[model samples]
Target: MAVASDKTTWTIALVGNPNTGKSTLFGALSGVAQKVGNYPGVTVEKKVGEVVHDGRRWLLVDLPGTYSLAPRSPDEMVTVDVLLGRQSDVAPPDVVVCVASAGNLSRNLYLVGQALELGRPVVVALTMNDLAEAEGTKVDAEGLSRSLGVPVVPIQARRGEGLEALKDAVESAGAAPPPTVPQVFPEPFRNEVDRLADVLNGRQLPRYLIERLLLDVGAHIEDRIGLAEPDRLQLRARIDEARKRLAEVGCKTPDVETTARYAWIARATEGVVTHAGETGSRFADRLDSVLTHKLWGSLILAAVMLLTFSAVFSWATVPMDWIDAGFEALGGLVEGALPEGPVRDLLVGGIIGGVGAVVIFLPQILILIGLLTILEECGYLARAAYLMDRIMVRVGLSGRSFIPLLSSFACAIPGVMATRVIENRRDRLTTILIAPLMSCSARLPVYTLMIGAFIPARAYLGGWLQLQGLTLLAMYLVGVVVAALAALILKRTFLRSATPVFLMEMPAYQWPSPIVVVRRMLDRGWDFLYNAGTIIFAVSVVMWGLLYYPRLSHEDLAPMVADRERAEARLEAAKAANDDAAAADAEDAVAAAENHIAGAQQRQSLLGRAGRLIEPLVKPLGWDWRIGSAALASFPAREVVVSTLGVIFDVGEDVEDEGEGRLSQALQSATWPDSGKPLFTIPVALSVMVFFALCAQCVSTLAVIWRETGSWTWPALSFAYMTALAYVGAFLTYQIGTWLGA
Candidate 1:
C-alpha cells in the first residue's frame, strides 16, 4: 500500500545514536540522489536524500547522531528543533525511522523511546544483526515488533540485506495511525508534563517538546519561544517546584527520565535479546587493552602519527611530481603559444603559477583525509581521543578536542570544522584558536625544503637515523608542544571556563567501508578546491601583480640585455669555429649577464621596493630583501614561498625544476649585496624554517576559522599572535645561533 496521501513526496526522518549504521543505510537507500547543505542559521550539516520506490518518493532527512534529544549545544539543538518541526526550513516528518544497533539494543532503544514519544508513525530498522550474532547475542525481531507494537525489520545496510522489506515497512508505518506507547514516567512527573503540555499547546508548540522542556534542565525551549523574562522565570520556578516534589517522593528528577526510559526498553526487549553471559573480552576489548594502555598506547599512538606524517611526505611525492610537471608543461606551452607581453605573463606566471602552487598540495591533502577516514571508519579515532583524554584534560580541554587537534596535522580547515563535536563553547573556541599551531601539511613543503638544503644528510645512531629526517620531525614536535602550551595559556587567561567533563562512546572496530572512505575523501578534496582554492588563487594573482607591476624602462634594461646578446653571439661564433673552451667562457658570460638583468628588474619592481622597506625589520632574523619578499608573498599559501624564491632568483617557477634542487642551489649560492658573503647559512636556514613553522601564513586557514567561529575576532587574534610568536621565535633562534658561531 502507498502512503503518498495524494502528495508527490513524503518526508521521512532518520534518527539514530552515533555509530548505529544510520548513515550507511541512508547512503545505500539514496545512492546518488542526495544533496548536502548547512541547516538554516547553523553550521551543522544537513543531508537529505530521495528514494523512489513503488510509485512513491520519500525525502529522507538524516539528523545528526546523538545519544539523546536534549539540547546542549547549537549542533545538538538542531536535532531537537528539526524533530519537533520548530525549524522553519524543514517540514515535520511523515514517518520516523529509528535505526538501532542490534548489538547495542538497550542503549540504542533509549533514542527510539524518545522518537516514539514524538507521536509520529515509527518503524524500527535493526542494523548490525550480524555483529550481534558474531558477539554471541541474538535479537528476536518478531518479539521486538510485538513488544513495541511497531514493525521491526533486521537489515544489513552495508551488505544490502532486507532493504526492500525495510522500505515496505516504512511505507506501511507512514500510512498507519501513530503508535500509542504507554507513558513511562511516574504519576507526579506526568501531571507536571501534562500541565506544561497544555501551556505549550496554547502557544502552538508540540507536546513532545514541552515534555522535553520539563525534563531537560537548561533546555533551549525558552530561547526558541522568545519567552520574556517574567514568564520565563515563572515557568522555570514551576519546573523547579515540580522537580523538587518528584525528588521528595524518593525519585531523582534529574535522572528519572533516563532511568524510566531504560526500564521501559528492558521490558520491551525482555526475552527478545539473548546473550551468553556478559560480553566478555571480545577482540576489540582485547585490542583496546594494548592500544588503550597508558604506556603502550601512548607509544603506539606516537608511532601511528609518525607513520602518518611520514607517509604524507613520501606517498604524496609521486602524485605531486606529476601535478608539477603537468603545470610546468602547460606553462611552457602557453609561453610558446602567446607572444611576450603582460597578457602572456599574467596567464602563465600569475594565474597558472598561483593556482598551481595551491593545487600541488591536493594529493597530500587527499592522502591525509583518506587515512584519517579509515581510522574513523574502523573506530580507532575514538580510542585516540580516549588515549589523549588525560593530557587534554590537563590543558583544560575535553577529550573531544583531541580529534580536532589531531586533524590539524592534515589541515586546520577540517580540524576547525571537527570542533563541532565539542559541545562546550569555551572548549570549542579554545580548540579552534590553538588548532593552527599543530603544523599542518602546508608546512611540510617548507620544512622539507629547508631541512634538505641546510641540515646535512648524515646518519646518527649507527646509521639508523638520518639527521635531516630528525630535523623535520623536530619541527612537527615543536608545533605540537607550542599548541599544547598555547591551549594551557588561553584556558588560564583569555578563554577561561570550567573544564567540561568528557564522555565518548567507543564504537567497535570493523573493516572500513571503501565506499565511505572514498566518498569522504572526495568531499573534503572538493571543499578545499572550491572554497580555499579560490581564495589562494586570487591572493596569488594579487602577489604576482605586485611583483610584476611598474615595469622597468627599456633604457634601464637595455645595457644588461645588450651584454647578454653580445655574449650569446660570442658563444655561437666560438661554437661555429669549433673552439670549445671559448664557447664555455662565452656561455658563462651570458649567464652572468642574464643574472645581472634579473637582479636589476627584481630590485626595481614594486614588490622589491616593499621588500626593501621590510628588510630592515627582518634583518635581525638574518634575512635579505629577497628572503623578505618571498616570505611576504607566501602569506596566502606557505607552499608558494619556494616558488617565489625560484622566481626571485631568475629561475622559472616550475615545481619540477624546484624539486630537482635548483631552488636550494640558488639559496645556497645567494649572497648579501653589501657584504658579498653567503646569506643562507645554517643559522639563517634554521631561522627561516622556524618562522614558517610558527607563522600564520595561510589565508585559507584564517577563512575557515572565521567561518567556524562566526566572527573575525578569533581569526584576527590567531593571525596576530602567531605572527608575533613566529617573529620572536625566529629572532631569538637566529641571534642565538649567530652568537654560537653555528
Candidate 2:
C-alpha cells in the first residue's frame, strides 16, 4: 500500500574512519566534476559531488574521515557538527551511507554503529572486497544486513562493481519511512544516563550533541558533584560498589555507551564472517622487509627523492625552452608592430616581459606534481612516513608531521592546512610555524639563473663528478637540513615538552592506476595556476609601472644632442687625415664627448634623480644605486629582476628587441659608478639566489598562509623569519666570498 512513494532525490553523507577507502570511493563516484571547498571559515576540506543512478539523482557530501566523532580537534568537530546540523549554516542529510573497509571491519564498525543509532536511513558499503577474499574471509552480506536491520553491500570501488546494487539500496532506503532513532544503551544502563543527564541540566551547560554524550557517560556528574578529601573516600567506595553491580548485569562503568556499542558489534559479527588462510602475500612480505627496515628504509626514501628531483631538473627544461622562445618572439613582434612609442613600451617591455618571467616556471610545477602523484598512488608514501618516524621522533616531530612538512615543499598553505592530521595541538602549531622555511618550487627560477650563469659545468674529483650540478643539489639539501634543525630548536626552547606519539595506517602496496595518477597531477596543476597565477600577474603589472615611467622623448633631446653631433664630422676627418692614427684618436674622443653630453641630458630625467637619491645606502651592498633600484622594483615578482636590470643599464632598447635572452649582455656591461667594478660578480649572484630561496617574496604564498592559519600572526612570523634569514644569509655569503677574493 505504501508503494515507495516518489522520493527520487536522495541526500547521502559518506561517513567512514580514516584510511578506509572513503576518499577513493568519493573520487570514483564523482569523477572530475566534484567541487572542493572549505567548511565556512575553517580549513577543513569539504567535497560535494553529484551522481545520477537509475534515472534518480543523488547528492553526496564527503565528510572528513575520522577514527571516531569525539570532537578532539576543530577538524574532527566538523564531522559531529555536520551530522547534528548544529552549525546553523550546513543542511542536515536525508540518508547516511557508512563506508567500511572489509579488511578492518572491527575498527570500522565503531563509527557505523554510532551512525545507525542516529535513526537515519543508513546503508553500509563494504569496501576492498578483493582484499577480503584474499584474506580468506567471506562476509555473509545478507545475514549481516538482516542482523543489523540495514542493507550491507560489498563492493570494490576501484573495479567498478556493485555500484548498481548500491544505488538501488540507497534508493529503497530513501523511499522507505525514516527509521526511529535507537537508544545507544540497554535498559539498566539507560537509567544511569538519565541520572547523569539530570546532573548536567542543573549545571546549565550548552546543549551541544557532544556535551550530551559526555553527560550521558557520567563525566558531567563527576564534575558537578565535587568531593573533598573525606567525601572522595566515601564516593570512591560507592563508585566501586556501583561498578560491581554493572558488571553483574554484563555492563561496564567508565564508558557505558562505548562498552555497549562494542559488545553489540562483537555479538553481530559471530558466525557471519570467516577467516580463510595465512596472509603471506609475497609482494607484501618483500615490501615490508625492505621498506620497514631501519637502515634500508631511509636509504630507499633518499634514493626516491633524488630521482624525483633529477626528473624535475632534466625533463622540465625542454618545455621551459619552448615557453622561453615563444615569449621572446612575442615581445619582438609587439615591439616591432607598435612603432617604438609609449604604448609599445607598456605592452612589450612592461606587461609581456614581466608576466613571462613568472609563467616560465609552470613546467617545473607540473612535473613535480606528476612525479608526486606516482609516489603517492603506488603506496610508497606511507612507507616513507613510517621509515622517517625514527628520525622525526628524535627531532621532536611526529611521523604524521612528515606529510605536512613535505607538502610545504610545494606550497605552505596546503601544508599548513594538512597540519589537521597532527591531532596534537602543540605539534601541529609548531609544524605550521616552520612550514614556510622549506624551499618551495617558487624559488626554482632564481636558483636556475644563478647556477647556470656562474657555476661552471666542469667536473671535479678527477672528472668523476660534475661540480655545477652538485652545487645546485647542495642548495636543495641546505633547505631541508636547515628546516629540520629549526624545527628541533623551536620544539626544544619555545614549546618544550613531551612529544605526542605518531600513529598512521599504512595501505598495502598495489600497482597504481594510470587514470588516477594523471587525474591527481592535473588537479594539482590547476590549483597552482588558479591560486598563484592571478597574484603573480597583478604583481607583474605593478612592477612594470615602476620601471616604465620617465622614458626619453626624441623631440626633448634634440637641442642638446644637435649641438654635440654637429662636431662629429670634424672629428672623423681628423682621424682620416692623421699619419699615425692621431686623427682617429681625436675623432674617437669627439664621439665619446657627444655620448657623454647625451647622457648628461638623461641625468635630468625623473628616473635619473631617483637613482641618485638611493646611491649612498646601496654602495655598501656592492650595488651601485642602479642595481639597488632594480632590486627594489622587482620585489613584487622576482622574474622582473632581469628586465628591470636591463632598463637601468640603458640596454632597455636591446632587451625589447631580443627579450630576456639579452640579459647576459646587459649584466656583462653594467658597472658601479663609484668603483667601476662589475655589479653582478660571483658573490653577488650567489647571494641574490640565496635570498630568493629563503624569503617569502611571493604575495600569493602570504595570502594563502593567512587564510589557512586564520591569523596574521602565523603568516607574519613566517614572512619575518624567512626574510631575516635571507638577508643575514645573503649578507654573510657576499661579504665573506668577496673578502676571500672570490
Candidate 3:
C-alpha cells in the first residue's frame, strides 16, 4: 500500500465511535503507507494512507474517533466539513467505512445512523467479533447488513481477518447507490428541520448541517452558520421558536436526536445481535477485579512505571553506546580527512556533533514509544486511567486527562493533540496549559546526562533500586506534582468549572500486535530523527557560529603559545635528564597554557558574551556564564543543551557512557577564572535539570498549543508562566540543596 501523490487516487474515510478498534483497523489497512500531518486551521490530525487495491488507488483517511456527529467547538465542526465535501483538499469520501464493535452494536449504530444521513456509500466493518462471541453473544453479519441497508462484514483487524472482505465491500459500495437512512426523529422535529431549511433559502447550507444547526444548541455550528447568514435575527428567532416547540412536545432539542437515533438503532439491531449461554469475558472480569484493587493496583502501576523508565535507561544502553561510538568515529573521520578550517569545523562540530547528540537517544525513544503503544493496544493503559481517576478528580479533572498526560511522557506534540477528546472547553484548556509539564522524551537526554554525571550509583532493596534511576524518576514526579498544583489553581480560579464525571469503557485484554507496535515505534523514531536533522540541526550550526567566531588572532594567542612551547622544552629536557617530578610539573604547565588559550577564545566569542549578559539573572541558580549560555541556546530545542555544553567545553559532540563521562568530566573540571572555584557542583546540576524539566522551551510545542487553542494568547501565556515557574523552581532547588550542604 504505497500510492504516490497524484490525481489517480480516491479517498475512503473511516468513521466510528471511540474504543471500537478504529485505529487498529486503520493500522491494519494502511500498514506503513501512512503519514501524519495537521489539517489547516483546525485541530484535526490528518492521518492519510495510500494503498493500491484491485488495480486502483485508494487513500484511507482515519478521522478523529468521535461519539457523535454533533458539532460543539470549532474543532468538532471540521468533522462535519470533511464528511460533507466542504473541507479543503479532502473530497467527500467516496466510500465511508463505519467501524463498529460487534459487542457494542446498539451504541455503535448511533454514529452509523448519523453517517447514513450523509447519503454516501456506507459499509460497516464489524470488529471484536471474537470478544463478542466469548461473552455468549454473537452478531449475524448478513442480518445486520439487511437491517441497516448496507453491507456488514465481521473483522478481527489484529489478526488480519476479514480484511479482504472489508476491502471488497468498500469497493462494491463505491460503485453502488447511496444506502438508505431510516427516519430517526419524530414528525415535529423533522418538520422543524425542514422549516429551518426553508427560512435559510439560497444560503446553500447542506440539509444535514441545517438539521445539526437546529439540533446542537449553543454549539459552534450556530456561530458558524450565523456568521454568513444575512438574516441572523430571522434564523435565531426561528431556532428559538423551534426549541420552544420541541420543549412543549416533550422532545428537547439535542436529547430528541439521541433518543430517536437509539430507538431506531434498537429496532434495526433487535434480532441481528443474540446473547449466548456462556460469558466470553468472565476471565477478563476476574483479572480486572484483581488489577483494579486499590492497594495492589497502585503498587502494580508503580512497578510498571518503574520498569518502563528503567528499561528506557538500562535496556537501551548497549545500542546507545553503539550509536555514540558510530557518531564519534564519523566525526573523527571527517576531522582527519579534512584540514582544520570553518568548513571542517561546521561539519564536525555543528552537524555531526549537534545531530549526533540527539540521534543517540533514538533507541530510548523507540523503546519508550513501543512500550506505550503496547500498553495502549493490549487494553491495560485504559485501566491505568481508571485506577488513577480518583486522584485526577481531586485536582478537578477526570481520568480522560490522564491519557494525554501519560502520552506526554513520550512527546508533548501528540499529548497536546490528544486533548481534543476533552469536551468541556475550560477543562480542555486547563489540560493543554499543563500538558507540557509532563517530562517528554526531549528531556530524557538532559536528565540522563545530568543524573549519570552527578547522581551517585547507590543500590537499595536487594540491588533492585538504583539511586540514579530514582533520581530520573523523581524528575518526572516533580513535573506531575507541579502539574497537579497548576491544575488546582486553574480550576479554583478563572477557569473554574464543575469536575466532569469520569466515564470510560474498559477494553478487553488481548495480546498486542507486534506489527502495529513496531510500525508505530519506527514512525515516531523517524519523527524524532527528522526533527533532530532539521530544527535542531539548524540551531546547532547557529550555536557553533556564536561560539566560534570573533576568532583569537595570533597576536592574542602568541604569548600562550610561547608559554606552552617553553613548558614543552622544559618537559623534554627533564625527560632527557630522567627527572620524573620535573617532567610532571612541566606537563601540568603545558596543560594550563592550552586551557588558558581555549578559555580566552571562548570568553570573547558571541555566545560567551551573551552568557555574561544574563549571568546576573542566573546567579541565584548557581549557573555561570557558560551554563547560562547553554540554557539560552537551548530555548528553541531543549535537547540542544547537551551539545551546546559539549561545544562550550571543547569536548566535541560525542558524549560517552556512564563509565567514561567525557563531557561530564569536562564539566566537573570547569572553574570560574576569577575565583578559581569549580563551576559545576551537584546542586547546580540539579538546578539545571529542574529548570529544563519545568520549562516550556520547545518552540514546536508552543506552536501546537497555538494551533489547538486557535489563540496566540494561550501559547504566549503558557510560555510566560512556564518560564517563570522554571526559574523559581531552579532557584529554590539550588538554594535548598546548598543550604542542606548537598
Off by over 4 Å in 1: 1-4, 277-280, 441-473, 528-533, 634-689, 698-712, 732-742
lDDT of 1 by residue, 1-742 (tens): 2344666688888989989999999998999799988887777778999999789999999998888877776767888788777788888788889999988899998888888887778899999887777777899999999999889999988778989999999888887778886687877788878877766565787777677777777656677777889988887887788778878886666688888998999899999999864353276678899989999999988777656655655677688778767777887889889997878877787666656645666776788778878988888888888998888888998788988888897788778877887877888999998899887777766776677568776765665456665677678888877788889999999789988888888886788888888887897788657633566566656766777777789988888889999999999999999999999999989977876776677788888999999999999999998889989988877777865665565333332335644456667777786677998988899899889888999898999888888899999999999999899989998999999998
Ranking by TM-score: 3, 1, 2
lDDT of 3 by residue, 50-111 (tens): 87778878989888887778877544577778888788878778888999998788888988
Per-candidate TM-score against the hidden true structure: 0.90, 0.80, 0.93
Q: Write the per-residue lDDT of candidate 2 for residues 208-280, one digit (tens) a residue.
A: 3423343234333343345466754654455555556766887765477577778888877787877876463
Superior by lDDT: candidate 1 or candidate 3 = 3
Report model 2's TM-score to 2 decimal places. 0.80
> Distance from true position, residue 713, model 1, in Å?
3.7
Error of 2 at 717 (Å): 2.9
| Poorest stretch of ten by lDDT in candidate 1 | 649-658
Query: What TM-score quantifies how close candidate 3 is to the native fold?
Result: 0.93
How good is model 1 by TM-score?
0.90
Clashing pairs in 2: 136-276, 574-583, 575-583, 575-584
By TM-score, who's the top model here? 3
